[model samples]
Target: MTARHAGYIVTLAEDIREDDADHIMTALRMVSGVISVQPVTANLDMAIARQQVHGEVRGKVLQLLKELQ
Candidate 1:
């Protein structure tokens, strides 16, 4: 099995022209607790992102995304 890390997954529009996965990853790093980012993609232009974070931060990254929504 793949090693586990504390983070969240993000999805974007398949046809979104400006699908900047790197930018999204950068934003994740700007968050208070995010430490790193991993970009994994699949067919149909879909992406699977994993934002590595500190254990003490718990769900801080998730909380930030919730606020954006």
Candidate 2:
């Protein structure tokens, strides 16, 4: 049977430096079977960020369609 695990929150031995977090997350995402990695923090609103990105992409596609018409 496949594991029903959703995800995990990895904590570093010491607080990750702002400059190093990107490198660390990138390395974790390179591991086999890893889907995605994001930094967890109180101030970061991932949902809103994802929605904004989706909206931007959608707008761009609509603009391209209009240009093609």
Candidate 3:
């Protein structure tokens, strides 16, 4: 099947620890549409969504990270 792609620039919550970020990355990778997750900084993450899924994936990832705040 052909898949759409979306780029995400996520900002991590200030209180989230390195371990938690690792966990979050793991979880994000498990999501259906996620292609890759990269940690840009303690406070920033970048992800690629392989299946855009009507544009919900990007917003979902953003919300998930923001929820950590």
Query: For each candidate, C-alpha RMSD in Å?
Result: 14.3, 12.9, 13.6
Per-candidate Cα lDDT values, in order, are 0.61, 0.79, 0.68
lDDT at position 48, candidate 3: 31
Clashes of 1: 0
List TM-score per model, in order: 0.38, 0.46, 0.42
User: Which residue pairs clash within candidate 1?
Assistant: none
Report the number of the highest-lDDT candidate: 2
Candidate 1, residue 68: Cα displacement in angstroms equals: 36
- Give a tens-digit lDDT track for model 1, residues 1-69: 899868877665443334656677678889987877766546443322222334336688778889999
Q: Candidate 1, which ten residues in sequence have the lowest lDDT sum? A: 44-53
Rank order by lDDT, top first? 2, 3, 1
Q: Which should have the higher TM-score, number 1 or number 2?
A: 2
Ranking by TM-score: 2, 3, 1
**TM-score, model 2 to reference:** 0.46
Instruction: Give the worst 10-residue stretch by lDDT in candidate 3.
Output: 42-51
Query: Worst 10-residue stretch by lDDT in candidate 2?
Result: 40-49
For candidate 2, lDDT tens digit of each residue in 21-58? 88788899998889988776634485577679899999
Residue 25, model 3, lDDT: 88
